[model samples]
Target: MQTSPQAIFFDVNETLLDLQPVKESVAAALGGSKELVPLWFTTLLQYSLVSTVGGRYADFGSIATAALQMVARQQGMEFSEAAAKAAVKPVRSLPPHPEVPAALERLNAAGFLLYTLTNSAADALEDQMTHSGLKGYFAGRLSVDGVQKFKPHRDVYTWAAEQVGADPKDCLLVAAHGWDVAGAGWAGMQTAFIARPGQVTYPLADAPDHTFPDLDRLADALTMR
Candidate 1:
């Protein structure tokens, strides 16, 4: 069993905040059904991995735009820059999922330091967090821009650990993405997987320390730890 951590670093996007609005926006922009949103999201992540492997980096928004265009092209639809921009706009306005606020409050009341680590640009992350009523819960927001790399990268996790002045072993990385948790675990940090539906688990080589269905469960487990 692991000891209670001094700090908890969370992943934004689908982890705490619901992406349904953004998904709906993308569907409307693409003239496709809402089901297509997951397809677009998957494509976006695939490109991020490709860019990382190729030693190239693009901001998350830029990547989202490109991925949208590609998804449009795949559907034999001409991409609309305006629609693409509109599709991504909801990202900055997404609200937290039902369990987020209460879970955050619980963790905060327990005296755990909370922070955010996201692939989003700082400006965008600030807007999203502030609008979601979750702004005050975090000590700071750590964007991938600082490291010029995306999640699953060791440097990004290490950078976050250093930023908050916490030891990797004493910090618990919490994210809905298995890859994010796996990467943090690989970086020597404890990890909790927030198992959002439809997301895949990472390979065993990159598995997280624990998996919970949502933030509430994670908070409860942390308290017990």
Candidate 2:
């Protein structure tokens, strides 16, 4: 049986916020090669971990721009970092997933303490939550930038838990990315894997405490508890 958690932490990008607009922007910049969007995102995540493990830190926007440039170069296209930044500029104002508002309302009404735990920088997160109209639902907004590490990094997860005054085990991390779920689980947090379209869990990782197709179902489940 699952017990209620002290707080629920959400991953910002692609979990609560939709990424389709950013994907389309990247595709257009890549000469309409929509196929490269996933590659660019994967590269972005890969290098985030690389920087963390390498004991270096760069803001998420800088890493994303660099990843875009790398993907462009692989396709034999010359892209300036400035161009890459422009390509992914839509990230800051991404809209929430369609069901996000109502689901968050339900969760908030149920008295669940909601907070965002994201890899985006503080300013970027503020822009996103405010632009997406999600700012009112959360009690706190946490950024990995504070710890100088990225998601899937144990330190980041633990740091978020500490910020919210919850034990790692008392926090439930909800994320669309497998790496985020795995990292939170390994850090002793309860995990809910939001298997959003095209998202899947890592095969080698421990299974999440809960799996739901979307936030609607997740809200249904959590509220019932």
Candidate 3:
């Protein structure tokens, strides 16, 4: 049986914040068609995985830019340095999902220590959190920039746990991505899957300890458990 968390670590992008604006922005920058949104996102994840396997590391933004260029080339679209940079502008200003603030407030009131772990840069994380009025709720924000590895990597979770001075088993990782949840589970942390629509779960090597339709449900489950 999983122990209740002493600290809950959340994934930034789709878990608590909506990335639709970022998707729309990128689509506009790519000539006003939203068709390439999935391609761009997939490319971003691909490069991050490749870099880790090849023992190389790039910041998320750098990888994002490179991936955009690659996707543009495949679509026979001309890539402009300016447009590529603009495509990522939304990352710095994404709004939190509707339930994020309320759920986070409830968690805080319930006395659960909270932290964020993301593939984004520390500054990017800070900007989003501050913009969403959630800066005060987090005890800390952790970025994978230093390690250059992405989710499903044991080292990143290990590093995050160490940074917060918590045992891996004592942390509950709440994320919308199955890979993030799998990674945390493999690292020995209990996992909660915030099942945002259009995302799917896989029969990965490690699986989440719990799954909920949204943050509000997750909060209620945590309270009950």
Candidate 4:
């Protein structure tokens, strides 16, 4: 079995926080078609990478709004920038997954330094943490905006490790996204994949050091470790 990590960095969206509210908002903007919600989110992630690869930086909120507009175009609907922005606004107030608070408490009490590493801007991350009531459990928050690159990027993972003053190998990146886990692994950090519903590891990527159905299970395993 592997030893415990010195610190843990969490991915914010769809990992600690539920994305249902934001997906509902996006669905409303897309004429009540829930199916289009995933398209918008995937488009947002795609364009974020485009921004990074092209050496340009745009805040995630702006990218979300733009991606919503793109989805509207795909469906032959006209979407106003203001309307799209409104749809993406609920992201700032998403609720934490039911098990997140208790799990975080367990991790914190176990003496692991907990921090958030996310693509959201600093202010946005603050709003999310405060709104979700998960703020007090964390010791700090790190945002990719600080380095103008999004997660799954090598620089972003390495940068976050440095921010926590931990060697990459000593840090554990706990994320619901397979891509995030893969990136952290590629960056030389330990990884725990929180297999949130519908999320799976990429077949070609190295397996995560730990895989659990939820954070509660992860906490149980970690404390035992």
Q: 1-225 in candidate 3: lDDT tens per residue?
A: 288788898999999899999999889877887999889999999889898888888788888988888888888887776779788878878889999899998988888899999998877888888887888999988888756788769999998889889899998999998888888888989889889998766695555778889999888987776
**How would you order the candidates by TM-score, starting with the best?**
4, 2, 3, 1
TM-score of every candidate relative to the true structure: 0.94, 0.98, 0.95, 0.98
Off by over 4 Å in 1: none
Lowest lDDT block of 10, candidate 2: 1-10
lDDT at position 89, candidate 2: 91
Worst 10 residues of 3 by lDDT: 200-209
Model 4, 43-105: lDDT tens per residue? 999999999999999999999999999999999999799999999999999999999999999
Report how far residue 23 has shifted in candidate 3, in Å.
Answer: 0.5
Give lDDT tens digits, candidate 1, residues 86-170.
Answer: 7788999999999999999999988889999999988889899889999999988888988888888898888888988888888
Query: Arrange candidates by lDDT, highest first: which order?
Result: 2, 4, 1, 3
Residue pairs with backbone overlap in model 3 = none
Each candidate: how many clashes? 0, 0, 0, 0
**Poorest 10 consecutive residues by lDDT, candidate 4:** 1-10
